[model samples]
Target: MRAMVIEENGGPEVLRPSEVPDPVPGPGEVVVDVTARGVNFIDIYQRSGLYEVPLPFVPGMEAAGVVTAVGEGVEDLSAGQRVGWAMAPGAYAERAAVKASLVVPVPDGVSDEQAAALLLQGMTAHSLTHSVHPVSEGETVLVHAAAGGTGLLLTQLAKARGARVIGTVSTEAKERIAREAGADEVVRYTETPVAEAVRELTGGEGVAAVYDGVGRDTFDAGLASLRPRGVLVLFGQSSGPVAPVDPQRLNAAGSVYLTRPSLAHFVADRQELLGRAGDLFSLLAQGRLDVRIGGRYPLADAGRAHTDLASRRTSGKLLLV
Candidate 1:
C-alpha cells in the first residue's frame, strides 16, 4: 500500500510518500480501500510536531471508502459495504484498518467524496450547534471563519436552528460565501473590529453564542461578541493556540462561558456517531446542507494540501482522492 508517512515531525515537506505494508483487519476492525481522504488542520499539527503522535505514522483522521475485509466479531458491517469514519488515524493511505464501531454506513445519495469531507468537520459543526451551546430560534450567534469547511457548516446548521448568524471572514469572496451559507451578517475582520461589527449587527445586545474555530486571533473578539451568560465554543486553534487567561476575565466579560470541545468527546459511542453522521447525510441528500470541495489532490500531494490549508487561502473542504 502507498501511504504518506511522517518519519519525523517537521513541516509539510516531511510528509513523504512511500510504499508501506497493507493494513489487515484485526478483531473488531475492518480494512477499507480508501476512495477519498479528508485533509484537516489537525493533520498539520501532528505533522508539525505541535500535536504529539508516535513516529512513522500516517497523518489523516477521516476517510470514506469500500470495505475490503471485515474482522472477527464484526457482524453488522461486511466486506463490500461502503463506509466512512472520523477521528481514526491511518486514513492518509490507500487502505486503513478502522474499528467497525467507529465506521458509519455511507447512504445511497451521498458520494464517497462528500462522505469523507463531511464526517469530521460536519460532526464537529453538529456538536457545536446542537450540543455545545444549542442555538435557539431567534437567538443570534457569531461564527468565525464562516467560509471555511466547519464554519460554513456551522453557519448553515445555526440557520437551520433558526438563529441569526453573524459570520467573520477576511475577504470579499469569503463574505459572499458566508452569506450564501445563510449568515444574516458577514464581517470582514481585517477591515473592522469583529466585536464592534457583531455588536452593531445585534443592536448592541451581543449574540447568544459564538462558534470560534480560529483561535488566538479571534478569541478575545469572540468573548466580547457574546451576550451576557453566552457560551464561546473554542473548538480549534487554526491561527494558533490561545494564551492563558485569568478567571476574572470571564467574570468581567458578562459571565460568559468558555468551552474547548473535540469531536471524540461528542461521539463517544457508536450510537452517537451513527446518529450524527446519519443526520448529516440526510441533510446532504435533501440538498439542505451544501458541502463545498475547494480542492482535490492526488494522494501523494498531501503535503500541498497541508500548505494550502495552513495558508488560509482555501475555502471549504480539501480532499485527497
Candidate 2:
C-alpha cells in the first residue's frame, strides 16, 4: 500500500510518500480500503513534532472507505460495508486497520468524501456545542475561525440550537463564509480586536460561550469575549500552543471557565461514537448541514495539503482522495 510516512518530524516536507505494507485486520479490527482522508491541524501538530508520536507513522486521523476485510470477533460489521472513523491513526494510507468499535457506518446518503470530511471535525463541533458548553436558545456564543471546517460546523450547530453566533475570521471571504454558515455577526480579527467587536455585538454583555480552536493567538480574545461565568472551549492550537496561565487570570476574566477538549475523550465509548456520527449523517442526509470541501489532493500530495492548511488560506475541509 502507498502511504505518507513521517520518517522524522519537522515540517510538511517530512511527510514522504512511500510504498508501505498493506494493513491487515487483527482481532477486533477491520481493514478499510480508504477512499478519502481528512487533513487536520492535529496532523500538522504531529508532523511538526508539537505532538509526539512514534516515528515513521502515517499522519492522518480520520478517513472514510469500504471495509475490505473484517477481523475475528467483529460480527456487526462485515466486508464490503461502508464505514468511517476518527481519532485513529494510519488513515493517510490506502488502507487502514481500524478497530471495529471505533468505526461508524457511513449512511447511503453521504458520500465517502463527505464522510471523511465531516467525521473528525463534525464530531468535534458536536461535542463542543452539545457537551462542552451546551449552547442554549437565545444564548450568544463566539466561534473563532468560523470559516474553517470545525468552525463552520460549530456555527451551524449553535444556530440550530438557537444561539446567536459571533464568528471571527481574517478576511472578507471568510466573513462571508461564516455568515453563510448562520453566524449572526462576523468579526474580522485582523481589522479589529475580536473581544472588543464581540462585546459591541452583544451590547457589552459578551457571550454565553466561546468555541476557540485557534490557540495562543486567539486564547485571550476568547476569554475576554465570554460573559460572566461563560465557558471557553479551547479545542485546538492551530496558531500555536497557549502559554500556561495563572489561575487568577480566570477569576479576573469574569470567572470564565476554560476547558481543553479532545475528540478521543468525547467518543471513548462505542455507543457515543456511533451516536455522534449518526447525528451528523442524519443532518447531512436531510440537507440541514453543509460540509464544504475546500481542497482535494491526490494521496501523494499530503505534504501540500498540510502546507495549505497551515497557511490558513483555505476554508472548509481539505481531503486526500
Candidate 3:
C-alpha cells in the first residue's frame, strides 16, 4: 500500500508519499480499501504539529471506502460493504483499519467521493445548525468564511431551518459562492468592516448568533456582530488560535455566550455518529444538499492538496483520490 507518511511534524512538505505495508484489521476492526479521503484542517494541524500525534503516522481523519476485510466479532459490517468514517486517524492511505463501531454504511446513491467529503464537514455543519445553537426560522445568523467547505454547508443548513444567514468572505468569488449557498447577505470582509457591514445590514440590530470558524483574526468581529445575548460558536482557528479570553468581556459584549465545539464531542457514540451521517447522506441522496468537490488529487499529490487548502485557495471539499 502507498501512504502519505508523516515522519515528522512540519509543513505540507512533510507529507511524503511512500510504499508502505497494508493495514491489517484487529479484532472489532475493519480494513477499508480507501476510494476517497477527505482533507481537513485537522490534517494540517497534525502535519504542522499544532495538533500532536505520534511520529510516523498517516494524516487523514475521514475517509470512504469498501470494507476489504472484517475483524473478529464484527458482525454488523462485512467485507465489500460500502462504509465511511467521520472520525478516524490513519486514513491518508490506500487502506485504513478502523473500528467497526465508528464506521457508517454509505447508501447507494452517494458516491465514495461524496461520502468522504460529507462525513467530517457535513456532520460538523449539522451539529452546528441542529445542536450547538439550533438556529430558529426567521432568526438572523452570521457565518464566517462562508465560502469554505464547512461554511458553505452551514449556510445551506441554516437556511433550510429558515434562519436568515449573513456570510462574510474575503473575496468577490467567495461572496458569490456564499450567496449561492442560500446566504441572505454576503459581506466582503476584506473590503468592508465585517461587524459594521453586519450591523448596517440588520439596521442596527445584530444577528442572533455567529458561526465563527476563522478564529483569532475574526474572534473580536464575531463577538461584536452578535445581538444582546447572542451566541458565538468558535469551531476552528484557521488563521491561528485565539488568545485566552476574559469572561468579563462576554458580559461587556451584552452577556453574550461563547463555546468551542468539536465533532468528536457531538458524535460521541455509534448511534449519534450514524444518525448525523445518515441525515447528511439522505440530504445528498434527495438532492437537497450539494457537496462541491473543489479539487481532486492522486494520493501522491497529497502534499499539494495540503498547500492549496492551507493557502485558502480552494473552496468546498478537497479529496484524495
Best candidate, lDDT: 1
lDDT of 1 by residue, 1-321 (tens): 899999999988999999988988999999999999999999999999999999989989999999999999999899899999999999999999999999999999999999999999999999999999998999999999999999999999999999999999999999999999999999999999999988888889999998988999999999999889999899999999999989898899899899999999999988999999999999999999999999999999999999999999899999999
Candidate 2: Cα lDDT at 217: 99
Residue pairs whose backbone atoms clash in candidate 2: none
lDDT per model vs. reference: 0.95, 0.93, 0.93
Candidate 2: deviation at residue 228, Å? 0.6
Instruction: Compose the digit string of candidate 3's lDDT tens values, residues 73-111.
Output: 999999989999977898899998999998999999999
Worst 10 residues of 1 by lDDT: 196-205
Error of 3 at 13 (Å): 0.9
lDDT, model 2: 0.93
TM-score to native of every candidate shown:
0.99, 0.99, 0.99
Better of 1 and 3 by lDDT: 1
Number of colliding residue pairs in model 3: 0
Candidate 2 lDDT score at position 215: 94
